[model samples]
Target: MKRTPLYDLHVELGGKLVDFAGWEMPVQYPLGIMGEHKQCREKAALFDVSHMGQVILRGENVGEKLEALCPQAFATLPKGKARYGFFTNEDGGIMDDLIVSNAGDHFFVVVNAALRHQDIPHMRAHLDEVEVTEIFDRALVAVQGPKAEDVVGALCPAARDLKFMETTVAPIDGVECRVSRLGYTGEDGYEISIPEDKAIEVTRALLAHEDCEPAGLGARDSLRLEAGLCLYGNDIDQSTSPIEANLAWAIQKRRKEEGGFPGAERIQRELAEGPARKLVGIKPDGRAPARQGVEVQNLQGHTIGQITSGGFGPTVGGPVAMGYVAAGHTEPGEQVNLIIRGKAQPARIVALPFVKQNYKR
Candidate 1:
């Protein structure tokens, strides 16, 4: 398995290493999943996300060319700003979700680590005349939580002015970095792109802050689950459409009307007429956790859907989950049952984000 630039640092921090998307990544640390989860919620936590792919797109009409592949308003995206989007297949199913930032002279894209091969090739094939360059010399680190700004701002004062979804070229200890004020943990934070050689130094500096500590994948997954965020392979895949995944908000008004992307027809149709199934939050009663692949049944014990992501939410103070269910049965307060271990467990469909998002708009 491939090791990220910060692999050694993670091991030194007592992180339990595990295989993730062909890379040996830290799943948790000595603080454990619960401790790290609460730490990020109440303060700040640093995540080693160097395994993800970072690509630079340039050339004439770059955003226009990119529109041919996905449904997003890239052409109109202002400089120093970031937007969340995904690649859709001919069937309107999500190929992979990504974050795109307009860096004035070029566009920077961050894709899921597992789908870099598939996503990069797809971009080169469809985005004609665009220079697609992948950056292998940088290691990505995310500082996330309510106190993230304080920890990061102390190193680079310029970063404090960046609002959520904003991006800027800044420095940490005089070393250049691409800082984006965004994260998946539903907190006010930033993802810093630093040189591979300086990754450990920058990470160590951030961890030195009183509010910042190292967190791993275990806490990352649980935090995103509580935030009602979708995981690429688990909550969404090639089989799930953007509309069904509750991500229509990411499709800007112009893209929705122009309809030039791969699955425009199907997406437009789904927009006009709702999808067959919709992704919604599931709240299991009592303490038993409902895990992925568990069948979701209606009150009469009829299978209606299945859980895609589930776990004990440290912030929600209970078991939280998200899954796709029959569109007609997606209303909040709707009763359902999760088939855990061949037995029916009572559950309910609630509004997404068991805990409110804390983005610094």
Candidate 2:
């Protein structure tokens, strides 16, 4: 397994290491998952996300060329701004979800670690004449939570002014970083891309601040799950379409109307006709913590869907889960049963994001 630039720091902090997406990363620290989860929610937490893939796309008509490949309307994306969308395959299934920022001279892309290799080849094959460079020399880190702004602002005052979904190259403690005010935690935070050599320096500077704590993948998963964000392989995959994944909001009006992407026909058709199944939030009556692959059944014991991501939400104060159910049974307050340990546990369909998102727009 690979190691990120912050592997040494993680070890110093007594993080529990685990294999994730071909990388040996910290799953949690001595603080544990719940402790780290609360730290990010109530205060600030820093995450080592260097394992994620980063690429730079530069060339003439970059926006126009990129719009053809992505499902979002990249042409309208202003410079120094970021947008979240996925690369869809020909069958309308999600190839991979990505975050793309439109820098002045080039577009910066961040893809899932698992799909990093496949994503680059797909882009190079489709984006003819575009210079696609994989940036392996840089390491990525995310500072997230309610107090993230103040913690990061102390180091780079310019970051405080960047609105959500905005990106800019800024200097933090003399380390030049491509900073984006975005994160998967559903909190007001910034994702910083810095030189691999400077990663430890930048991280130490941020951690020295009293407001920040080191969080691991355990907390990261719970935070994003509570935010109703889909985990690439768990909640969404090549077999899931954006429409069915409840990510239709990411598809702008122009892209939905123009229909030029790989699965435009099927995606647009699903948009108009509605998908057969829809992703919905499930709140169980008790705290059994319905896990992934658990069968979701109707009141009559008929299986309707399956739990994709489920766990005990430290913030939600109960078991929270997100899964796909028959469209008709997706509305909030609808009753369902989760087959846990061979017994059916009563649950109700609730609106997504068991906890409300706190993005600083």
Candidate 3:
């Protein structure tokens, strides 16, 4: 498995390493997953996310050319602003979700590590007019929590001014880095892209803060789950359409009306008429966590859906899950049963975000 630049540091910090998306990543640390999860909720926690794929697109009409690949209105995207979007297949299925940032003359895209191999090639094939350049010289890290401002602001004051989803290039500890005010933990934070050689130094400096601690993948997954954020290949994939995944909010008004992107017809149809299924939050009745692939049945015991991502939410104090269910059963407060370990367990549908998002907006 490929190792990120922080492998040695993870070892030194007593991080439990595990294989994730072909990378040797830390699943948890000596602090434990539950502790790390709470630490991020209450204070600041740093994460090593260098394994994600980062790419840059150049040439004229970069955003316009990019619109052909996704449903976002990037043609009007202002500089220093980043927007979340995804690539769609001809059939309206989501290929992969990504974040695009307009950086002056170019656009920077960050994709999931596991799907980068396919996503990059897909972009090159469809966006032929744009100069697609994969960036391998930078490592990304995130410091997230209520106290994130104090931890990162002490090192770089410019970051304090950035609102949610805003980005900028600034010098921190004498190294210029791209700092974006966004994160996966549903907390106020920043994702910093640093030079590969200086990654360890920058990470160490951030960890040195009294309010910051090092968290791993275990806590990361639980955090996103509680935040109601979708995980690629799990909650969404090539077989899932954006509308079905409840991600229509990412599609802009102009793009929705013009119908120019791939599978625009199907998407427009879904917009006018809801999809057959909808992804919704699930909360089990007991302490037993209903994991992925578990069959979701209506009160009458008829299978209605399947759990995609499910786990114990440290903040929620119970098992939390998100899955696609028949449109009829998507309403909150609806009762359902989860087939866990061959037994039916009672559960209920709830509004998304088991926890409130703490973005600095």
* Model 3 spans > 4 angstroms off: none
lDDT of each: 0.94, 0.93, 0.94
Alpha carbon deviation, residue 55, candidate 2 (Å) = 0.4
Q: How good is model 3 by TM-score? A: 0.99
Cα lDDT, model 2, residue 206:
95
Better of 1 and 2 by lDDT: 1
lDDT string for model 3 (12-84, tens) is 9999999999999999999999999999999999999999999999988989988998999999999999999
Model 3 is weakest, by summed lDDT over 10 consecutive residues, at 122-131
Model 2, 113-187: lDDT tens digits are: 999899999889888799999989999999999999999999999999999999999899988889999999988
lDDT of 1 by residue, 1-361 (tens): 9999999999899999999999999999999999999999999999999999999999998888888888998988899999999999999999999999999999999999999999999998888888999999999999999999999999999999999999999999889999999999988999999999999999999999999989999999999999999999999999898999999999999899989998888899999999999999999997999999999999987889999999999988899999999988999999999999988889999999888899999
lDDT of 1 at 267: 90
Ranking 2 against 3 by lDDT, winner: 3
TM-score of each: 0.99, 0.99, 0.99
